[model samples]
Target: MTGPSPETASRPACWRPARADDLPAISAVLTDPAFFDVLGAVTPEALAEACAPDGARRLLAFDIDGSLAAFAYLSGCDGDRPKLEEFAVLTRGRGTGTRALSALLEVLRAEGRASFWLHVVPDNSRALALYRRLGFGREEVLPDFWQTRNGDRVDLLRLHYDFVPAGV
Candidate 1:
């Protein structure tokens, strides 16, 4: 990993909109063995789309001491529904994903988002617990929701976080 582990690094105050230059490290993390199931395919083309001023796909990165440590991948924010496709840490167990993801969530809230959704592999118990602890409600099981690069079907647990509850 290019950056310090979560426990050793100073906690970042916030996340920033991902820039073109962040692509390399962001690519490295997403493609790393620890997170590839989400997507090892966050290509340059995709990064371009994410960095575009009006594109739907958005990338938010949190760095420590100028190196990439974590990033959140989101899409369709301008519409009624936004999906948090990935909120990944460069390493698997440094334990900073919660902090980074919390900061990233604020970025979305600042944009006037009322709610957003994410999906995680059912088997990733740690991630599931983390999201739940952060107040994401488990919505349902989306069976065979995705097909991996290896042509394997993966079922995901859909989760939702509402900044403003519906009945409020």
Candidate 2:
């Protein structure tokens, strides 16, 4: 759905940078079967390094009712164009991802970025629908872009969103 359900729409959004200690919780949410297929067998140590407090990347989390609801990882953050590396939402079909992503786009806009980009598996129509609804456009296809833990290579469709500052 493009819009969050009314109940979820009113819920508060708690987006914060993920600390080193948050890796376990983050790893749990991501390794669940709901997400494990796409994420593969990610380890906590790997998460710690990827989500390190260093300025090179931005790993943000979204919480609801004091519980982890979503996680977003951005790379190439030291540059003008940050790449949205990963987006995982524990709560789906509740408009959680949409709202969470909208919040992230605003953050990028506030950062004065001209644009941000992400890659999604072509088969993830649900995510593709959401991306398109949120103003992302297809850029190109990167063949064999993702290598899963099972030795399977996956192609990804690159999508990008250009920032539109408030009031145009």
Candidate 3:
């Protein structure tokens, strides 16, 4: 799907690798109320660890204003594909998630990754729709996949996408 265009309505966010100096901004974005509601509790240390690219890690997203927009991290899976462990954006209704996702696909393409997969709470309709728009398809749904911060268990929907180069 085509990404948000650079227009007056909303400037598309800039994409880059996570920097050591961006830890504070990234932490705030990840631990925001919106994030907590969807992703449950997130610790600062965990965010820092993910930001540090030791292996097949993530590339962080920053907005045009230089604010931390989102992050996408992956780890080795059973085969050549990588499992998208975490992907979250700070703001909504501005296509920040779309921008971040497009950037992620580019990075994966650069690395020649065959596929990327992730799991999300089934009830997160916004995220589900976004993933669908980005070419991800539901592989399975696991019951009682995780517990929320409020101690409520929830189901998880696993999604996968096989990347195909243009003109292939």
For each candidate in turn, the TM-score is 0.83, 0.79, 0.76
Please state the error at residue 149 of candidate 3 in Å: 1.8
Structure candidate 2, residue pairs in collision: none
Q: 1-168 in candidate 2: lDDT tens per residue?
A: 486667776777877888776777777776676664466454566566666545777778887755678888778888878998778887679999998899888878888888899888887888989999999994699998887655679888899887854357
Best TM-score among the predictions, by candidate number: 1
Higher-lDDT candidate of 2 and 3: 2
Weakest lDDT window of 10 consecutive positions for candidate 2: 34-43
Q: Rank the candidates by TM-score, best first.
A: 1, 2, 3
Clashes of 3: 0
RMSD for each of the candidates: 4.0, 5.5, 5.8
Residue lDDT tens for model 3, 1-168: 765455622755566667777777666665666555466555666556556555554545555555677766566723558887767776668898887887777777787778888888878899899999999984698999888665778888899888864357
Best by lDDT: 2
Could you tell me which residue pairs clash in candidate 3? none
- Give lDDT tens digits, candidate 1, residues 82-106: 8987777876677678878787667
Candidates 1 and 2, the one with greater lDDT: 2
Evaluate residue 110 in candidate 2 and report its C-alpha lDDT on the 0 to 100 scale.
88
lDDT of the candidates, in the order given: 0.77, 0.78, 0.71
TM-score between candidate 2 and the true structure: 0.79
**Which of 2 and 3 is ahead in TM-score?**
2
Q: lDDT (0-100) at residue 64 of candidate 2?
A: 76
